[model samples]
Target: MKTKRRAAYFFTSLKLFLREYRLFVLLGCLCLLGGVVVGVLSARSFGEDYYKLNFIFELHSGSYSFAKTFFLALLFGWGGLALILLCGFNRWLIFPAFFLVAFLGYRLGLGFVGCLQPSGAGGVACVIFFYLPLYLTAGTVFIVYICMVFSSICGACGVFSSASSVKRLFFKALPLSLVFAAAAFFSCILIPLLYKLFFM
Candidate 1:
């Protein structure tokens, strides 16, 4: 009887948390969808190195061979992360940049992008293996934490401070973005290094 009651209570608590962090949950769901889409599209385009989401440029042996693949990863990963953050206005990001990039990239008819666009084929993993799972987790953490902080601050300010909705939103987003960026960045490094240790 106690076990069943405890389980029910735990689930009820979980329901409360979920209700409180609905924004994070929503962002998590969308980012998850984005990851799968990113992963699949990457595999189709990058072939073997789809795992690294590099080899699209910098060449295994070419003129810019000294530049390395890490640059590609950083560049695109940062862009994608920022796009996910700044533009995620309640859905699919509120900006045309993300929309256009996602569409222009994803809507190439499900084939390989390297073949289609000369500058295509840069990508990375989105599937749940480990470590990288925290990429989404970190982002979601930021989302939830920001909401909590934002609400708390607004409440502190009596909801009628000189701060407009835009100001409040900015406060919520900027700090959260920075925190998430740090977590995500570290995760990206950690994932590759950890994977390398085990596999390579």
Candidate 2:
């Protein structure tokens, strides 16, 4: 596709995904609800043997703790898109990106939940503020990949994965890769800004 057409397709793709406001609003509602609940739950509270963060809490309510979990899930959902695109780009790196993004999300989620504790505010208060927003931003980056990946794979035969098609997928993913990097950058700026916006 010509550059203009391609960019237009890309923007259209964004509009289509944004139309599903429920998923985003669902998360937003969860975050708001968390602060209103009366108890908290930690990773260990669930007894999972997987990687765990030791911080615990008894918050204004448990509603916020559950909201943090939703935030984390949304975060990993970003990594999941990154993984799918990694597969599209250099099939070889797919698995690594998948695990790394997932690990980041899980560990970060744990840390964030810690901050939501009734008294857990301080320097990283900013970090906690942007968790959900970052998830939404990164998710858009992922959605673009989904669009490109689907276009590349939809009409192909069962077994003959074409190198040209892979290349196209990679190129399509280039902007999103930049987007992910930029998302991280903007996230750094956004967190502090969000902290001021919400807490200052």
Candidate 3:
């Protein structure tokens, strides 16, 4: 009964958060999509050599180890969260955050294009097994963090400029941010394991 109540409360809070910040979520998605489209188009012009030069591709080509992958993902996830927190202090910082999210998408697009180069089937599998989980997890982290930062900004700024408003915003976002962080960490761990299971 206690667990059931907790679960219900969690869902209700999640629904409220989504309802309140859906526009920010949509904006993040659009930016990511735009970057992806650009990356896919550019990949065709740049050719395979260009993607080979990419750090992610280089890493992917190397040994698939759990520690290395998890460390890298954790680094990126923490870095993204740091950027979002920085953005909360100043409006100008949001531009860099936006660019970073889009850049992630661009990288994803490059990976997808590289995978699909020779044939479709293997590429589809790679996307399913690897790219979707890894990049999508990162994307989810960014979107949630960005939404939280945006809300905090609104609370601090002229809009919603009450002490209680700011406090409420911070407390509400804190738990969600922690949840996303854990999700990102789990994805990092999961990705390498998945690679070993399917590819190795």
Candidate whose TM-score is highest: 3
Question: 9-105, model 2: which lDDT tens digit per residue?
Answer: 9998767765654453333334333422311234437644321221122122222243454445545554565466545544344335333333444
**Candidate 1 overall Cα lDDT vs. reference?**
0.44
Query: Model 3: runs farther than 4 Å from truth?
Result: 1-11, 50-66, 154-200
Residue lDDT tens for model 1, 30-75: 6445654774566566654322223223232232232243344345
Model 1 ranges with Cα > 4 A deviation: 1-17, 20-31, 34-38, 41-48, 54-134, 138-163, 189-200
Q: Give the TM-score of candidate 2.
A: 0.45
lDDT of 3 by residue, 1-200 (tens): 99999999999999998899998788789888988898888988876544442323444677445566666766776777666666666666777888888988998888788766644675666566566666777787788878766766654352245567456655655665566556555554564455556755
* Cα error, candidate 3, residue 161 (Å): 12
> Which lDDT value does model 3 have at 161?
53
Q: Which rank order by TM-score, best down to worst?
A: 3, 2, 1
Lowest lDDT block of 10, candidate 2: 54-63
lDDT, residue 23, candidate 3:
86
Cα lDDT of model 2 overall? 0.47
CA displacement after TM-score superposition, residue 130 of candidate 2 (Å): 3.2
